[model samples]
Target: MLKIVVLVSGGGTNLQAVIDGVKDGTISNTEIAGVISNNKNAYALERAKENGIPELCVSPKDYDSRELFNEKFLEAVDSFEPDLIVLAGFLVVIPAAMIEKYRNRMINIHPSLIPSFCGKGYYGLKVHEAALSRGVKVVGATVHFVDEGTDTGPIILQKAVEVEAGDTPKILQRRVMEQAEWKILPRAIDLIANGKVTVRDNRTIIAE
Candidate 1:
């Protein structure tokens, strides 16, 4: 079975999606090894505990520098010997070392379409606000491979939500997240696990 470690910084809706998928056979041949967070107060930890999965909290403030933080983070994750790492609402910028170590095995689900409303300081509600402000007819979420840049990895899957005229950030986010995140994240993971995803010149090729 493929072992997975999830990194979360907020509510674990996506994490829950993964868990439910695995349990219900939507995602097969994988086990959630553990869940880790930078914030001790993160609600995701409770979700992990509820599932009887081991959980760890490593505060970035405890480390002297980004390098140290990355080292410690890697140590915590390495303990599980995970085959893949999933970032579910994790807020920190991953260090290059970890990115290099995991490389294609790391994935993240962003709340908005990439190359649009992404990068540092563009997370959660901010992404939704940006979409509404831009008057985009469509808003959606992306599941992509994790690289050194913020949300710039090769895309694996995306699902769009039509931006309604009266849509508030919250309303738009709710609709997009329900369809995009809960659906695409698991599909991306399944694609990787089944060897149906390949990176060709920085693009994702999903086998038909």
Candidate 2:
């Protein structure tokens, strides 16, 4: 069995996907170790409560310094000894120290195709807004290994979604979540949990 620690900040729609997958045995041989958030009021905590998973809230504002905040957050994460750390809408930027420590053991599912509507200043509805603004015919999701940079990690898996006409950011966001994000995320977790993922020279080779 694999132990997974999930981090979230907002509504936790992706977190719900993971939880449902585990409950239904779609993601077998895995147990959610815990869920942690930077915002105590995050609805994700409520989701965790419903699923009977432990929750940790370590808000960045509560700490006097960035280092202090990172140290405390890492401590909570380390306590679980998670086999995989999934960033499901966690808003905090991971420090280099934590990135190096976790390395390929951590993964994040971004809302749009990587190398496109990603990087700093691109998140939530903003990503979809950019896509619509640029008129990219297609948009999707990417699950990648977490490196120090923003969404610049080694690509693991991606699913594409067509940009429908008359699509607002909210509409596209919902579409991407349904058509891409929610699907590949848990599937990636399952592949890693089942010993089917391989990292080679900064790229992931999925075992078929």
Candidate 3:
């Protein structure tokens, strides 16, 4: 079984999707070893507890300094000995050392199609708001490797969702999450766990 550690900072809707996928056998041969969060009050931790998955909180506020927090966070993640790390709506910026160590072993779900309404300051509902302001007819989500730069990693899977007429940011956010993010994030993890995904020269090549 592939052991995975999921990182989250919010309600963990994406994390719940992965859990459901595993239970339904959509993501076969995988075990969610643990769930980590920066917020102790995050509902994701409660989800993990309810599911009997190991959970930890490594909040920056708990540490005396940023460096200390990073170290503790890394230690917390390593304790699970995860084969894969899933960033499912995790808000913390990953430490460079951890990214270098994990490399392609870590993946994240982004709220936008990427290369547009992505990168810095473009997370959560902000991404959808930007797409609406740009008047783009299409909005979507991306599953990508976590690189040193924000949302600049090799793409693994993308699903486009149409921006319907008179859609507000909140409405579009829900649509994109349901149509795109919820599906592809688990699919990407399944592909990776099954050895069907490969990264080459900063690009992803999925096998049949």
Candidate 4:
């Protein structure tokens, strides 16, 4: 079985989606080994506890520098010995060392189609706000490998959602989540866990 470790920093809605997918047979051949959060009070920790998965809380503030925190963070995550690391609403930049070690072994779900409304400063409602401000006719979600560059990883899967005229940031955020992120993230996880995805030349080739 593929063992997965999830990183989160919020209510864990995406984390829940993965859990539900695993439970409902939508995602198979995977076990969520653990969940790690930077926020001690993050509800994601509660979700992990409820599911009987090992949970770890490591605050960046505890460390004097981002470098130190990165070391500790990588150590904590590697302790679980996960075959795959899923960044589900994890709201921080992963350390370069960790990214280098993990390589294609880690993945993240971004709330935009990527290459547009992605990269630094394009997260949470800001992505939707930017899309709306740009008067985009469509918005979507992307699941990609976590690379050294922000959101510039090889795309594993993408699902687009229409942007309605009257959509506010919050409303658009919910729509994208329901229509895209919730679906493709688990699907991408399943693909990777099942060995249906291959990375080559900084791109992904999904096997048929």
For 153-200, candidate 2 gives per-residue lDDT tens digits of 999899999998899999999999999999999899999999999888
lDDT tens per residue, model 3, 55-74: 98999998899999999899
Per-residue alpha-carbon lDDT of candidate 4 for residues 1-208, written as tens digits (9 for 90 to 100): 8899999999899999999999998999999999999999999999889988899898898999988998899999999999999999898789999998999999999999988999989889999999999999999999999989999999999999999878999999999999999999999989887899999999999996
Local distance difference test scores for all models: 0.90, 0.94, 0.94, 0.93
Worst 10 residues of 4 by lDDT: 91-100
- Which digits, one per residue and each the tens of the lDDT, describe model 1 over residues 1-208? 8789999998889999998988898887788999999999989999999999999998898989878888898899999999999999999888888899998899999998888899888999999999899899988899999988889999999988889888999988889878789999988887777788888888999996
The numbered model that scores best in lDDT is 3
For candidate 2, list the clashing residue pairs, or say none.
Answer: none
Worst 10 residues of 3 by lDDT: 111-120
Q: How many residue pairs clash in each candidate?
A: 0, 0, 0, 0
Model 1 score (lDDT): 0.90
- What's each prediction's TM-score? 0.96, 0.98, 0.99, 0.98
In model 3, the runs with Cα more than 4 Å from the true position are none
What's the lDDT for residue 89 in model 2?
A: 97
TM-score quality measure for candidate 3: 0.99
Candidate 2: 10-residue stretch with minimal lDDT: 94-103
Candidate 3 C-alpha error for residue 158, in Å = 0.1
lDDT of 2 at 134: 96
Judge candidate 3 against the unseen true structure and give its global Cα lDDT, from 0 to 1.
0.94
- Candidates sorted on TM-score, descending: 3, 2, 4, 1
For every candidate, C-alpha RMSD to the true structure in Å: 1.1, 0.7, 0.6, 0.8
lDDT at 110, model 1: 94
